[model samples]
Target: MIDKLSWMAIYPEAALLIMACVIALLDLSTTSPRRTATYVLTLLTLAVIAVLTGFNAAAGKTIYGFGGMVVSDPMGNWLKCFATLALMVTLVYGRPYAADRGMLRGGEMFTMSMLALLGMFVMMSGSNFLVLYLGLELLTLSSYALVALRRDNALASEAAMKYFVLGAMASGFLLYGLSMMYGATGSLDINEVFKAIASRQVNHQVLVFGLVFIVAGLAFKVGAAPFHMWVPDVYQGAPTAITLLIGAAPELAAFAIIIRLLVEGLLPLAIDWQQMLTLLAIASLLVGNLAAIAQTNLKRMLAYSTIAQMGFMLLGLVAGVVNGNTYNAQFAYSAAMFYIVTYVLTTLASFGIILLLAREGFESEEITDLAGLNQRSPLYAGVMAIAMFSLAGVPPLVGFYAKFAVLQALIASGQAMHIALAVFAVVMSLIGAFYYLRVVKVMYFDAPLTATTVAAPPDVRAVLTVNGALILILGILPGSLMTLCAQAIVATLAS
Candidate 1:
């Protein structure tokens, strides 16, 4: 049933794949010091994709193509647009840092990142089990190479190996679950599977058995505690630039798949999955925040922070279908989406500051490395301070609102356990604030570790400024983005 519209549905993805190949060839042929040609080409490609995606989203029509294996909808389009923007900013903030560390010796970083982005695009659009799994592999394979790009760093190589082994295991869990699902329902299409399950035409026990594995796989992907062993090590060992690449944008893709699998494909099993998510969220918040309090490395601390933040997102998902009614589905899912989007924005600036502080031979991996950052460069310190405060869910910042939205969704569910969950989340967040504020305190109150002035290229500085400003502006006035999320989710569920 492939048609012209099927191809049209994938225009942005097609353009990116072609451009990535062209850029790879151009990088090999050109003899530029900074690989300026490749950099410009990559950014231009991303900008064009972003524009196309925004246009598609604004059109507000849901199109299913490729025999219903791929979907073009407001939710997918908006996530793709933002993911492309995140990649562009990642490259901009990363270039100087990558160049300083000789990571630009080859163009693999740029090409691989572009490919990983393509994977995200596919994941967002996938409406079939096989398509989703394929997309996940593409992204993880590219990320493995990116993490080990340094080749000479033992720690980097070790992190890559660990990520590879664990990622493969998770993929197997997902695949095995998908097979069981297909056997139970006799379909690979997500919508059809949903129909089968919702109609009570499938064996309930088999479906739930398969769902356990699927949830386990997704839990690993999102780095929930008990499955987050690789996060801290990889964040600490991989180059900061690669860590940012892994952290910032792929989260949108992760959220997309969660919706496609759990909500769209298995809503009939909400009571079952929600129970699992509840346990995962509680464990993640408990382990992530408490363990982070002991870390000295900023990256590792942020790694734990990412886990806790993801837990908060899960809270939204768990509250979506209380008492077998989905009247609140859009609100709950939209809150989770908004939280992920804003978290990525703050993360970009947080890691951008770390990347900026690293000089020719100095890596700012330790928290003490930021001691008295205000004395060295008030502007950079201020940006970092804003990011830290925002992540801590402090007042008048986006993080607080993100948490508040999720907690509100949880409390509104009217389940006693959910109300308890909301209270627990607040307490865990209060504990987590200690580490985030510690970073800020060191920046403003401690003595400088070195007298060297913080410096960054104009482009990096410009991006960081915009990133920080957006965090504050969105915090103060979050209506537009929140509305957008609500619209996107409503449109998705309707389709």
Candidate 2:
């Protein structure tokens, strides 16, 4: 058991879970008396755990435990780091948004966020269907609570109810698929399932049925089109802070599950699944991008954009060329990983500013909310512009490099139709840019609605300022990061 525990590697998750429970217990004794303490503890635990986990693991290695239920590998480690950092940023961004609205201490949102993060950690490292299900449930339950953090906001409550019910249905589909796979292969382990697929002749009926449910469930989590009805409403209704966390962290975590299940467990069925992903990629690309043009609410626009962004990510996976004939496979996967990192940074900057700009009783979801931001605050306006441009895939930004890599990979793979689709993605990208740029135009070109300036906390400003700058810096120096992404993905796939 002790030996198994070593492989289980229960340090980071265990520590985070303990910290969350302890903080919740303290909150039971004193309500909102020391939310700052909770925030500080959560940050410290995450930072310490990130460092310790990196130090403990050998890079490019997979450490397995629980009889192959969970395996912490390079992809999981990197994404865990990404998720932890994104969560911390979300906490800081939430501080002013919550404080100004009298909702900072609302139902221990911070504690619930940490718990969701613990679930994400598990999902990122999961190797078996059972472990993935458990982790996803933990994440979902906590997210529901966070969305409903403000008891008085009927909108928040309604959003939470919708999210909860839909999330349950998605989980049911995932579980059904898992059951079918287990029945077919007599294995819950992803690797063992792969082995079964390799040895046994294809069972078209069972395989097709299980594959659809599994991909559908993952698509639901990633906010891919056709399963994306929940995204816009949820983003528009939830507290801005909760919306930020949901936007940045959850989809990336979902990507982890997709990599595990699809690349590992279902690779043999690529002929069957790739077509499905291509259809989804096109649907999401068209719907998410085209629909954003109609949305005046900034968050909802971004929500639809999120679905579109997932389509771009799916494009890379769809172009999964083997490592033969010149490393294109290696390039595509790396580009996808890099795309996630870029999305995290860009989205954080955008949301961080939204938090800073929001007035009391206002969530800053409207483009006009940013009118004459340049006159009000040049620094804020500049940062927001960078985020907007980066999101739009404009040149000299991280977003461009991420998209370029994926496009190159698809084109290289002889998938000309998909390449044409990606080109359409580029055009729709320009269409989507109109909404993002609308905010910028309001900020830089128009007049301010008020004379007094909105105040941003030092910590929040510091983080946003840096992240905003980092996107451009990365855009300039993308080679090293691109190398890291390429190497990490290839190594992960090869492993």
Candidate 3:
């Protein structure tokens, strides 16, 4: 029977849901074009959720609720905390852009985003296949609505349709795989499935078949190549504000589900899934880097860059098990966690600049649009440069250390194949640097298209400044965050 402990485990989620409904109703009375009342309440709600999750994460205790269908653990809590903050930042950076584009006519953007975040929380906390699938659908459905939020835009309508059809297919793949696992193991619970597989009582062929579809679904969610046909289009076609909304926080949820499903639930099948992840990583790097190099559109370029970055993150997961020994798992997974966190930080700052420049009718979509950005507004340019440099894995930036940590994890595995993958990843990063630096070059060296200084709301300016500074500061002092990630992973593994 459900008890207080079950309710305690999900207090933050409950608060978010309640507040989202309240904000939707509150918007009816808000006459302000910017929906200031709704926006402030939403931010306050997210802040409270972040603080609550942060405290829970720091407590470092695992709590199971809803008959173990959901779990509250350090890793999940920390991820939820970060996701909350990311969403808050996305909303802050996005609001002005949304207001200008008439997308904020109602409070659907704010309410839908909160609901999407609630979905992410569910995904991260889910310990059962059915719960996880429900979370995934909630997130995807919200995303489809968000992408098509601007009902009058043809590009948005097209993007929404594509995302819906493709997203449905991916969901089917994941659900089918989960059903097959249940058929084989006679359980929907992750731990029970793990135990069944470890006991060697399941049909190996059926398990492998399910595993393939599971990996495919996960790859699609993370925007890995061969299943990444939707990323660039959606990113470019969606209103810029909505693009940032979908691109940033959802990644953390994706990583969380991957850990819950593959590492936690199916560790016994490590060899099979590891092989699939390696292939996915390699293809993601190849396609992401090469395609990004040819892109003139900044959003599309970043989309491909995201695919490549996720590939590097996957390398950390690939190194988690060596010869079936899980000794390296904590460090490897922590590296991935750290990498995703830093990537989201950098993405926020980069996109914040794009949103700032996309004033009213002027969409700063092309790389040329950033020409002489330094001359127009050095502050935004500097933020964008830091983001680009970090993304390129340049020194004294978070991205460099993020890449280094993952590479270190790979090399420590002492496997020749892992080492070779590390080397290949470095080569791809070298190729990636050209495109990132090209943005910096355009910002600094090229002539300005117009001499208008970029103006931003005080809130956006403050947040963007801090966001960029954190990228550089974290790069210089990464030990604390690294330790936090390690501790979270250790606690999770112990639990």
CA lDDT of each candidate? 0.93, 0.83, 0.95
Worst 10 residues of 3 by lDDT: 1-10
Candidates arranged by TM-score, highest first: 3, 1, 2
Q: What does the lDDT read for residue 327 in candidate 2?
A: 50
Candidate 1 residue-wise lDDT, 1-495, digit = tens:
568989988888999999999999989986776789889989998999999999999999899889999999999999999999999999999898888888888899999999999999999999999999988999999999999998888988998999999999999999999999999999999999999999997889999999999999999899997888888998898999999999999999999999999998999999999999999999999999999999999999999999999999999999999889998899899999999999999999999999999887888989999999999999999999999999999979999899999998998888999999999999999999999999999999999979999878889999999999999999999999999999999998997
Ranking 2 against 3 by TM-score, winner: 3
- True-vs-predicted CA distance for residue 83, candidate 2, Å: 0.3
Alpha-carbon TM-score of each model against the true structure: 0.99, 0.95, 0.99
**At residue 187, what lDDT does model 2 achieve?**
89
- Extract clashing residue pairs from model 3: none
* Backbone N/Cα/C clashes per model: 0, 0, 0
What is the C-alpha lDDT profile of model 3 across 1-495, one tens digit per residue?
A: 679888988888899899999999989998999898999999999999999999999998899999999999999999999999999999999998899899888999999999999999999999999999999999999999999999999999999999999999999999999999999999999999999999998899999999999999999999998889999999999999999999999999999999999998999999999999999999999999999999999999999999999999999999999998999999999999999999999999999999999988878999999999999999999999999999999999999999999999999999999999999999999999999999999999999999999999999999999999999999999999999999998987886
RMSD of 3: 0.6
The 10-residue segment of model 1 with minimum total lDDT is 29-38
Off by over 4 Å in 2: 4-8, 28-34, 56-58, 321-327
**Model 2: how far residue 354 lies from native, Å:** 1.0
